[model samples]
Target: MTNQGTRQRFSPYITFSREEWRHLRDSTPLPLTEAELEQLRGINERVSMDEVADIYLPLSRLLNLYVAATQNLYQATNTFLGHLEAKVPYIIGIAGSVAVGKSTTARIIQALLARWPNHPKVDLVTTDGFLYPNRVLEERGLMKRKGFPESYDVRRLIQFVADVKSGKPEVLAPVYSHLTYDIVPGEFIRIRQPDIMILEGLNVLQTNPDGGRKRAPQVFVSDFFDFSIYVDAKEEHIKRWYVERFQTLRETAFRDEKSYFRRYADLTAEEAERTALSIWEEINAVNLRENIAPTRNRAHLILEKAEDHTVRQVLLRKL
Candidate 1:
């Protein structure tokens, strides 16, 4: 579409500005405390409770409300249809760029929503578990494009989610290790009946490759989400975050003897900077541009953040 046509269809996309964007950062009646936030702090320092309460607490509340509304709607439907059966799991998706604090957001929301009396037994599963084993990626010469849509076993992922949403008795998802950056062998996480399931990862919203009858089933992962959130920030800010996270890992996680990235643990400051930027430029940036960013419109809500990693504005899809 031409710029004029695009403008006519998506006026909201072009209207947000730093000066005009304002949402007060305040706590809820029952907010996540500093101790609670500390439990969620990942290997990186970017995620904290203030970030959660200011940004993700509101998001979690919104998701809870959405799930409740969905339940009410389903009950009304059941009454009209004259059938009685328990509803399926409510799925929530979260997408964001690498080093944009997506994992932290997922963990925080999972913890908070579990505390909600209405939606207990909330389980968090990541699409990283759907990634093809390293051997497969190497065989396909796709190791460099690990985060690309093609690198995942999309069929298995879609099937697992479809089964869960269809009220399947049990669904087993593969386990992935951050240290090795690959699927662990002989290990799978079993998700039983749960009130809510939070699916988190990069490229979770990408479309399937096969376009056939059995292959091209329903919508992708984003379709299963009762509510979806995409963390947003300037590209420069994300780049800085990537560099900072890499530095932290060098001093911490990478130092683990069993880590696959252990070789990088001894990298000098200069060498580490070069290595981080190289990976970002070659792999992460390409995947973000070609795969992830395009799915921004598929989200139910967008939390736009500033350079200092604070949410500055929120773009919500009008229902």
Candidate 2:
């Protein structure tokens, strides 16, 4: 083959099937029990012990190694400068479409990585907290675009990530409530200096050259991340998951009087499914295609999921 033709077909990622990736688990042990995992998994996600052992265990071992190496480099830099520098937390960004289980992945990875002796403290912050309040979104006529990049208080979100990455002693992230579907008034999640931080959201890996505000920095959130992961699956599967989760929530959170989706609580099974599918097609799917999926290749690693919510392939970007 001609050199030019050969180069055209080159793939930058090393793809591994479930079994191939499972073997990479090596001596890593599963630290969480069945009960603990029950708490970690999402409403519609099918995360099991086998999934953890085959997928996350190996991934966590890899992340542990990355964190350790990064720490060593930080120390090395300080040594060369002949001065002590504050240890910065290793930030990990997990991005994917809504209802694609990125949140669950982030939690799993956080739980796994925290058990490692070297990096015992792991913090998780989701971008939902950075989304504009309902009133603000309404003012901007962006209620339908809640998960879109433009619906975020981008400046504040960037500042939060910057502050955390700068080793700030205390940082407060606004709390977002699923039931209320808004940023909780005056509520916040306090984050101390952690060994590692996992920031999960749809747009963590996305970059906007001109942000919504005049003073917003052009810096991407992934810029501060030492590593990034994109949880991926076929759109059809994700749509099904979304519809299923919405139906489940109707029986649970939507029944709460305070829920933003309380009106949906009375929907029939068919009506609920139709509504959820409509939402997927209108808002979430559009966001995924335009802003989120485009950034998948930006991730250092991508976890491709099967229809049953199992991770079928792990694609690690070649160095």
Q: What is the C-alpha lDDT of each candidate?
A: 0.80, 0.91
Best by TM-score: 2
Per-residue C-alpha lDDT of model 1 across residues 138-165, encoded as one tens digit per residue: 9989899787888888879888988889
- What is candidate 2's lDDT per residue for 3-96, written digit by digit as tens? 8556545977888889999999999989999999999999978899999999999999999999999999998999999998766999999999
TM-score per candidate: 0.88, 0.95
Instruction: Spell out the clash pairs found in candidate 1.
Output: none
Model 2 misses residue 205 by how many Å? 0.9
TM-score of the candidate numbered 2?
0.95
130 Cα displacement, candidate 1 (Å) = 0.7
Query: Lowest summed-lDDT stretch of 10 residues in model 2?
Result: 209-218
What is the lDDT for 151 in model 2?
84
Best by lDDT: 2
